[model samples]
Target: KSLTSAGRTVLNLALVVISSVAAIGAINLSTRESSDSSTFLLTADVVAPTLTLSNSYERRDGIVLGEGFYNDWGHLAEIHRSTRVEASTTVDDCLYGWTKVDTYGTETFTGYGDQVEMIFESVGWNGISLLIKCPSTEQTATYPVMVKYVRREIRLLNESDRSTFFDTLYTTYTTEQVDGERAYGKKFRSIKRLVSEHLLGAADKECDHWHDDAGIMTHHIAFTLEMEQSLQSIDKTVTIPYWDYTQDAYELDDWTDSDIFNPAWFGMASPSSKDHVITEGRWAYMSVGKQADTDGVRNPYGLLRSPWNTNPTPYILRHRYVYDEKDGGWTLPGCTDFSSAWSYNSLGEYFDELNGELHGPVHIMIGGQWWVNRTMNFSATNGGDFLLASKFLWRQGYVRCPELCSDDTPDDRCTCSCPDELTRYFRTSRDFLDQTGLFNLSDGLFSDWSNFATTGCMTPDDCFDTVVKALCHVGHAGEMFTSAAPYDPTFWPIHGLADRYLSLKRIQAHENETILSQMWSYSHDGNSPSDTRRVCDWSKVGDTMGLPDCYVGDCAGHRAQDLLPMGNFLDRNESYTNEEFYKFMNPRNEELPYIYDSFTQWPACTDQAICWWNTDGAC
Candidate 1:
């Protein structure tokens, strides 16, 4: 049944009007503003590209509204707080068998180690749907997880106002349960129960109260893994399975610390979505202690080498750890877990003791959790999985493994225990206080006899001051002072006044070694001629573009294609996977991760050509 020309024209006109109305609906939703003066709005120019126009309205801007309407993975903010769990292994069964004239005791042991570690972070929006991508593994079978999420004061801006709104905006999307399936709904309820137990206001079932708030709502998602759950395993996989977004289900004021930082705020990649966004899209910073140079030997310091050394390389920063007495020496109260937070908290306390509590913002060390994705090296539970303990091992030289040590053997080894590692990680945390003369100790350049006037210690009383200077001379030496020295310690021990100084030097030296090792490996590994840049005088084939001479050390010889066309990150340590390279080399019809802005969109390649090329290419 073919329609006449008149009927066809009417249908076409109807379709255009419907699309326009839908676009308008999307705009209206995004433009809901707060009562405060900081209310957000979307500008005409910014959203015009996402909208379609009707015949009566001119399509001057060609805006296609709702294009970015869904809160996809790329633009969401991550809120993280430390959490913990406990697990223990117990003997399963025992039996006795008679042999000859004697009865022997036989034992069948099925033990489960109680798992406990700070669930430091989670990603999600307030009171919205959440999906967890639990890797498929044997451990997840027994202890189906009871995950929790907590949302705090942070608001998700409903921006429809300003030009910059779209740049920073994120959307919230939802999912529904299948017919006749109560299991999915029940599982989601279990997750909420865990959040209630650990977080405030969750117990009252008041999470829905957040809808009444005047501004954007923020709900944190948290989950508790059952004893059978193995978070570090590759085979274990789990998703939110379901969500309850009723306004009454969330209570923002009841949110606490644990509630503020939960993983559901950020979603994992779906089977059809971009892998990089779920696994490694955002920028994460690594804290490199002194092990940057260490070889096969992996001590406490070596733990710092995890993801960068094992997974695809990401951005990295190498610096000394600072110590603070306030945060209880990097130990969070009621939680035995150790992390960068413990270090920062300790430093904050230490500063307060010396300067009576700092009055302003403090720079804190950060370690990203994307590396915690099951695909990376840190996911496994092994003696060497701890960076905090490893840093201590490197600092103290050696000690019996605390988590894996034997009670029968005397706990004696040069190797560092967990506490010692925490100590080492905080090496330069006090650089600011040490340089401000709070403790009154001065050395090196400042101690120069010729520079008595500048040292501020020329007087008899000043000469006796004894505060050790920080590892780096990075502080402002004050207005009148000049010749502020850089903390390049040539000689300093791990103890006494020189401890911080020595650690700083050791870290730098190690970083240099990491750079050199990777450079050499990149140059010789031949499979991806495109992977290794021609940092040297080596000639190129085709569009083999190398980075500028500025990358002499770390990123030397790497091509612009090696860096750009994916993202413009400056971290040299992050490396591309073999699959990524195949797609890059042959990108015409190839579904590639590099093509769609972030690594999330890059599709994994399976070309036999790539396999043969890499194998025979020998790189």
Candidate 2:
């Protein structure tokens, strides 16, 4: 069952009230002094059992066919994960393995390494903890894992509308056997979910996923989201990262040109999906690290998928607008005598406003290759999609908590498995956690990705935050961030942050040739007509790299006052017209946590202000 907008609003309001009451300690049901009364400060602890080599079978001959040759033969990477024997526990160890299979039945063995003990301990919110020898198999290894989230589907109107929607969307495949060679191979796949019924596609007769199962397809949307964090700790596991793709024979360099992104061959790319491209054109959305533009006059926002190599050349994103009679087609937006922001009425509009008939949720399908299929840690399609979404949230605003800072209000627990990319940023920022929460099997870093497959389909409401935090941590933004604010703390500081804005900018330029050309020039010559470089460059922007050194401790023998002068002022006390501050601090909070105290005061200021930073070019 999916939630409607009204339902979402209700849920949001209910949560706000509940959270507010909890924070102020206003709603107490206990009559006498409670024996165990402690103000709850949200915190998370991550734990993953250290994998140890119990045994391994490499290039072992296994499986058989009718002929002399072995039908299924492949090299295996096997090992066991061991945990210290505890007085209360029954199991002390876990065994696991990873295998690389070849089609021709030839096997080659690879070496395995040491076994680390799984240690479950308590940690402070502000201290740092790490798994001493976690398995990566190889450097740049990305273990495929899923981060599950809650999704809500909505049907705007009554039964008639609902019936029509289901009719067009729901379809089942049935096959009849005629000859030994097989007579028919027709499987039904619904297209109604691909294009908006209110837009140009529904009536088209050519759409394949279209059907006439009125009641079933009536759902206008399938809005899935994270409700909490979902993580797990396994005795033993395997991890394969993005760099692994380069090892594949068929993997392509660029997403658009790669087998993974190809719609026809691999069946993974869904360019026709509403969320994949700009409604104005069939241009697929591109990321920031990938954008480059050289020529000043060319389209800066153009869909850029550069050819193999160019010396010092900037390849900005570029896309083609191909109009087709087919339901899924591109059309550009424009204005003659009037001017209104193309996608929104005003800047006040949030993502919900942009998620209209023209805009759609991204659909990611993961398992096209064997590498994705064999792993229990991740679901090829759904897991990857959710993980990406989770990473985006973490990158944009989420902050990491040190294990030592347990007394303070920590945003969420850090699983030791928090993406290494993010851990680098936190370590650089000195945001280590020493002790605050207990690190058990449930809260371990390595465990989070593994929990998604089960928690996603079942305990969605409870796992949303966990999923969001985990995904956000793994993505590229973690290493890129130079700030020290959690998602909520640095809302304004990081609002319109580097990654997301660039993504939006790329989409905006997809259909506008003039804008595309301008973006191209800016990317290539560092002359963005729209001054987008300010948003793209972390060094120039107000990131952690350029911030004043506000730390004082240890061997330097410096005075604490000098390092943290006006440390009390570190707490926010601004009276902004909006809730940017609360949003900045407790970003994931449904309702902002209002902190009223002189200890939590911000210096009086009109415009957003930061200390010791100069704009390189322009804003």
For residues 494-569, could you state the per-residue lDDT of candidate 2 as single tens digits? 1111112222323334424113221101011111111111111123324332322211112110111112101111
Candidate 1 residue lDDT tens string, 1-619: 2113322332232333333433331111122222432332323212211211111001222321111211221111112222222222211221111111000111112222222222212221111101111111011111111112211112211122111211111110011122112423222222112222222211111111111111000111111122001111111222111111111112232111222122232221111112122232221121112222223212222322221122112213211122211111121111111111112222222222111111000111111112221221222111111232222122222222222222233322222222333324444323322332212222232233232233343453333221111111111110001100000010000011111111222222344421111111222221111112112222332222221121122231122233211211111223332223322222121111111111111011111111111213222
In Å, residue 357's CA in model 1 sits off its true spot by: 22
Alpha-carbon deviation at 598 in model 1, angstroms: 14
TM-score to true structure, per model: 0.19, 0.18
Top candidate on lDDT is 2
Deviation from truth (RMSD, Å), model 2: 32.0
lDDT of 1 at 85: 24
Model 1 is weakest, by summed lDDT over 10 consecutive residues, at 485-494
Clashes of each: 106, 115
Clash number for candidate 1: 106
Where is model 1 more than 4 Å wrong at Cα? 1-256, 260-297, 300-322, 325-552, 555-619
Residue 317's lDDT in candidate 1: 24
- Please give the CA lDDT of all the candidate structures: 0.19, 0.20
